[model samples]
Target: MCLIFRIILTAWLISSSSLSMALSIDSLRGVEKRKPNVIIIMSDDQGWGDLSMNGNPNLQTPHIDRIAKNGARFSHFYVSPVCSPTRAELLTGRYHPRAGVYSTSEGGERINLDETTMADVFKEAGYATAAFGKWHNGMQYPYHPNARGFDEFYGFCSGHWGNYFNSLLEHNGQIVQGNGFIIDDLTDKALEFIDNNQNDPFFLYLPYNTPHSPMQVPDKEWASFKDKSLIKLADARTGEEDVVFTRAALALCENIDWNVGRIQNQLKKLKLDRETIVIYLSDNGPNSSRWNGGMKGKKGSTDEGGVKSPFVIQWPGTISSGLEIDQVSGAVDLLPTLADLSGINYSIPKALDGISLKPLLVESNQKWPDRMLFSHWNGKVSVRKGRYVLDDNSKLFDLTTDPEQRVDITSQKPELTKALSMAVVDWKAEVLKDIAIDNRPFPVGHPDYKYTQLPARDAVAHGTIKRSNKYPNSSYFTNWTKNGDYISWNVDVLSEGDYAVAVYYVCPADEIGSTMQLSFEADKLDFKIAKANASGMINQQYDRVERMESYEKDFKPLKAGVIHLKKGAGELILRTTALSKTNALDFRMMMLTRESP
Candidate 1:
């Protein structure tokens, strides 16, 4: 049967069953031995130390901690250094770039639709799958969760949502305005899904966008962090903005915990608690401000602090309670582990790089294979095997002995470093081979594009930009040179035709009210002005690249417009209102595609 037909038939079955008497718990137990429902909840930019169980005295994460206390807590779990890559690995059981997701926001990088996802595996095993919260994998129709094995999808498609309250969410394929706080609304939708599917096996993937940026929280929650004078010094020393850091971050975490508590309460109310598998983890490591479990490095770096995340699994009768495992775990291992646990029968593509951890969970004494875990964010790569870790800058460390990654053993352990370096090289070669055969580029115009000879930038040297507090200013145009902006085209076209020019950019939350303009100037043509309206963080400009036939008929010499430029030199001017240091922008991309006749 066709996949769409199967989906439609499943929906019909669900509807028919809903009209009849709701299936009781006992009835569900007898019907085909219902598999345990799986719920994977992930938080964005949450630190390792953010949980109360992880030695944080200020932050109370009772709901999140309950998972650890009730089930297994992985003491040495790791994920990719950043959000998108970690998410890619979590869904595909492979490295992020191999799954077609490289950086967080670079265009054209998406979770390949052809590749199987954890949701697809569960759906094939007769489970209803729903995804809510941040769906940053891709924003296009074909790449959306609903199209990629999810029955329902409700969330933002970007990496981070600016405002915590009254956020913009996409329900299925339509954009919907949400009420109350973003996390709370997502939790409500998740609970509803769980309650509706309490009788059957279901997969709920709730990846919350919280504690990320523009940290705004409810007043009551923010009040708790106001009097913590001890944390103030630490926050100040770290150069964290107090207004946005302490108040917003604390509130965001507290809110996330509250929503988690709500989900747990719903499971109990519906008596699906024991038959549900709950997995709680963070998308990546903390970004600064709040807690970090005292590891090294921050958000984007490949250090332990950036990649090491708290992992908790809870299934009352099925999983051992309060067990702490020191074995290394990663997000990539989730798909295979879930498939094995739920009795899903399907062959994973040979491209997958993760092993099933179900053996470790079921047979406590089962020995896990000693394998190397690789992480690459942007262009930096890090490979870890047992105790040793190797990075691009030739830095190596014994994480087993030095958890903080303070002691560099590169000079002392040459043999170990060489072995790890060789492993990394081999892994990179494999990745490149996959890239070549899979027909997937990192992202259009990404700095890591194939055949590009530019040297990779050092991850450590790129300092974090401070959060802008004021609106954007037009005067800042002087700082932004035209050459610095990113531009790319599929091919050089000799034909003079109109094309669509799209520019992706990001500005501070406070600069939402400000106006920005892009002026395109070329030879003997009227300048075109494209105005930008703040949507989330970025302002998008989609305008026509017009070529007047009156100026030049033949395609001999391309007539330059105000926006279009000559081969040697051309410029586009950006203008915005005068404001304080309240705005920051990253021109993600500028693309020119031939407009259809």
Candidate 2:
């Protein structure tokens, strides 16, 4: 069955089941009046209490706070314990595991290609769709934004970027240099997209990578809080140990707020503010220890502070102003709610784990449904009912009394715990049923990526046999030196064509003549080290964090001739053929350039 036809039938069935609901996505094409435009602005690592609206006294975020002041605020919003999974959940309206992303750059951080994205539904319904900022989901074709129903994508494909200033970014799959801070650049691109598509309804996803790691912020922004005396956060009620890191995180968030102001202002100026549904949220909990709505844990843990992100939505005239909805919502709810508002619906391979929040958002103080929300990370799962939480260890907590989750009350409420436990077991079974364990391979014959970098640090990225990083570039490949080591990259080829191969490594004078072979399917090509030293260049253009100097001195190049390739799913292997003087030269990455017709 064709996707459009399948969706049309599914929409009719689902809509018939609930006659009170709006029309399904597939039928939105004929509406003469413009549908609502959507702009989802998600921040990285900005916790529940990061905003002054949530009562953090260290910094001020008036612009972001305005969302809650002007629209509906979801006080108990939840997300994944990490960045990537939450992103997958938000895009697919399903649990992260169901979307095929278990963690960041590991356990299939790349979303499954077959899964239907929110962009797919909106684009199908005649909405121009674009994704700006961090797209931690996938780097390969079929999983990339352009392939996953997004008409335009401007951001890095990796899990995270290293540098924010004057960084190289992917603009519609082409590497384009971005000026100024990343947050500003992302918002500027979003404004440009909005301007270009003002005549039509558009869906814009802006996920900003701020306050997550590397702890780098603009000097002027940091200087404002750098000199302030260290003090405990009002909500935390305790002194923070790392003031510098927290201050930097705060400055980065405030910088994001400034950009949010830009977006909101642009919307109002274009008179699209009332027609666009603007949402504000964070990917996960705070990276540093500070006030996080008085919750107990930080990022990567299945705790309130870890997964709870502040979510505020403003759909002018449709959603009433200054209302607070205390429903327990999660990132999975994003897609469904967007679909409901846009009146687009479709049947996907996996059943959605989220319920639409359209009723609560559009109707004032509506009766919200109470459903169990489950979260899992690092082998531990946390399930939440109305006021209760059950962790994987069978420890239970009454969130009403202990929002911080400081005490485990499993013994006090064995019956509640038992029921929640059974629910978690069932939930996990449902979400993990369709998960594919194999790595989604990089595309070899795709036109989007001219050069593919197979790094050693990625979860699927590994050297079967090798030495470790001696001189490290935290963002690039590290392992090298073993005599018969081979690094394999799982990838999908969209077409059959020839490609030029290059091996990036460090070679000493004594081991200059070593050779490595690139093999795919039944074809193999060999490249020899031409020089004793590496080429004075760097493949990792963006810094994950702020840095001072260029770290490109140790890298040299080896040009391997082109090999005629048969297009299909296969592993590309860089195998050590013959060592010249010592072990295989320190391997960095293998680059493949797709040959043009």
Candidate 3:
């Protein structure tokens, strides 16, 4: 009986040890497969309320809402007040100006190639990276996405694309013509990149340019909105003479939603659903259209409407479903968060003002550090910390209670306001210190935008107009006499295209011919002067004018301009530049928009 008992005990011990060994092996395999494929889908100028989930009664964004339902929705996500700056923050995990992008016009300001990027971190971690969409970073050779860390690049290099139906896109280094809608083309390229790189870990950035200016949409999408009564109502409220609720903008949103669904479905089809992480966000707040998530202000302003954006993330089997996090976050947080998730190790550049969000994602109860996030546009700066926000004008708000920023608490809390104001000033000083000057001479010398001597006078007067030798003889015409004066400036066009001559001038009077001019040298071109009758105008009586006339004349190929100057300096003589004598010409800012070759 004793021998038999010993034999049973020995067999039991052997089985237990074998089971332990097997469990350890499986644990190691799980760790090996833990790295996730990351996808960041960003929309251009899409407001927080534009999605169906955000309570927009007019627009439907089912696919975007899915990300919120399946994973987590960030109720308080912030971004720069404009596009390029927000993009810079997203890529470098730092303030926009620190990464060399202060505004959309700062295209020549390159994001230092040496700076560590979110894509660089993922690529270094063995993830194939691709950015498919509007890459408004720099279009110069060294600053393109390919030159950065992206393995494949497809999209426009400019801030906005003019035509969505047929647009000029840059594939890697080559500019290519894309068919169909721009949104679809971007999505198609993204899906192709995903399919090609499905076998390996990958990072995909899909930044869709939609719901922006030149608001347009395909006919089929527009048809869905034809029956809606809200469209007519909104038009009536705004006193809009033309279509107020643009079917194109609505269709664009729907198209973006469809693309989101396509990407999500692709992951499921590839069996990568459980291993992929997707993040959806907007580059900035919405432009003047649709719903702005009930927030105040719109694009270009430092208000909530300009900075607040919709942010959602989904990771099947990892993130909890239907979770809502109301913490404050910004585009600057993306880099560190992505790096943490992908297991990438690298120190960020000096003073990178972002905190990693991996702890928040993995542990719901984790507390974020009390840190400040900053944003700027057009010299306006805003700083937010916890529930408090400080703007340039010393306005303070407890965002926790007044998310709309309706009531200012500066007078009530003087000390707090002073501290916040100082913080912004210090931060701005740091950013300015980091701006590395572009010593390289301007390829197309300084632009020739008219500069007026006085606020009201509209007559070309004394001022030396400077330009790049690339376009020699291009001169700026400023302070021009508004009545019966013709001003002709010469431009050496480096390339031929459907060029539109645009001039920024002030028409303080509402009368017709308050500003009138004709471009005789190029072609017989005339354009009606629209009043820049913005609410915050210095002279409310007269409207500011920025006139643009289409010059449909064909020109010499390869050369700057067909009409050369006698001494390589062309004449920009002005005469009969009529305007209401009561309405003085303010300033003249000139630039040409190249349509096509």
Q: Least lDDT summed over 10 consecutive residues: which range in candidate 2?
A: 466-475
Q: How large is the C-alpha RMSD of every model relative to the true structure?
A: 13.2, 10.1, 12.3
Cand. 2 TM to true fold:
0.83
Best-to-worst order by lDDT is 2, 3, 1
Segments in model 2 whose C-alpha atoms lie over 4 Å from true places? 1-32, 234-240, 407-413, 432-436, 446-453, 456-474, 478-486, 492-494, 501-516, 527-561, 568-570, 575-593
**lDDT for residue 122 in candidate 2, whole number 0-100:** 90
Q: Which candidate tops lDDT? A: 2
Model 2 C-alpha lDDT per residue in residues 1-597, reported as the tens digit of each score? 699999999999987877634445435654455789999999998888888888788788999989887889987889988888899999998888877787576326788877888889899888899999888887666567888889899887776555577666767755567878778888889999999999889999998888776566777787787766644452453235466667778888889999999999999999998899999999988887786767877888788888989899988888888988877888989888888987776666768888899988876547776689988886678999888888767789988788888789988888988999998888778766665466555665576555554544441334445324321222444344555567676766676778776665666676677777778889888877767764444433333234432243344446678977787887877777776765556665555667765
lDDT on C-alpha atoms for all candidate structures: 0.64, 0.76, 0.65
Q: Candidate 3: where is the Cα deviation over 4 Å?
A: 1-31, 106-109, 231-247, 433-597
The TM-score obtained by model 1 is 0.70
User: Per-residue lDDT for 408-442 in model 3, tens only?
Assistant: 99998899889889998897787866454643211
Candidate 1 lDDT for residue 475: 8
Which sequence of candidate numbers ranks them by TM-score, best first?
Answer: 2, 3, 1
Per-residue error (Å), model 3, residue 328 = 1.2
lDDT of 3 at 309: 89
Q: lDDT, candidate 2, residue 240?
A: 57
**Model 1: per-residue lDDT, tens digit, 1-597?**
699999999999999888664566548666666788999999999878777788776678999999988998987788988887888899999888778776565333468867888988888888999999987786544566776779998886666554456554568754457777778899999988998998888999999988766455666676676555434223232235344365456667888999999999999999999999999999777766445645666688787777888999988987888887877779999998888888778776646788887876767578777788887776677887876777667789887788767778899989988888888788778774554233322221111111110000100001232212221111011122222222221221222334344433444344333333433344222221233334332111100111111110000111112233232222333343332334434333233333322
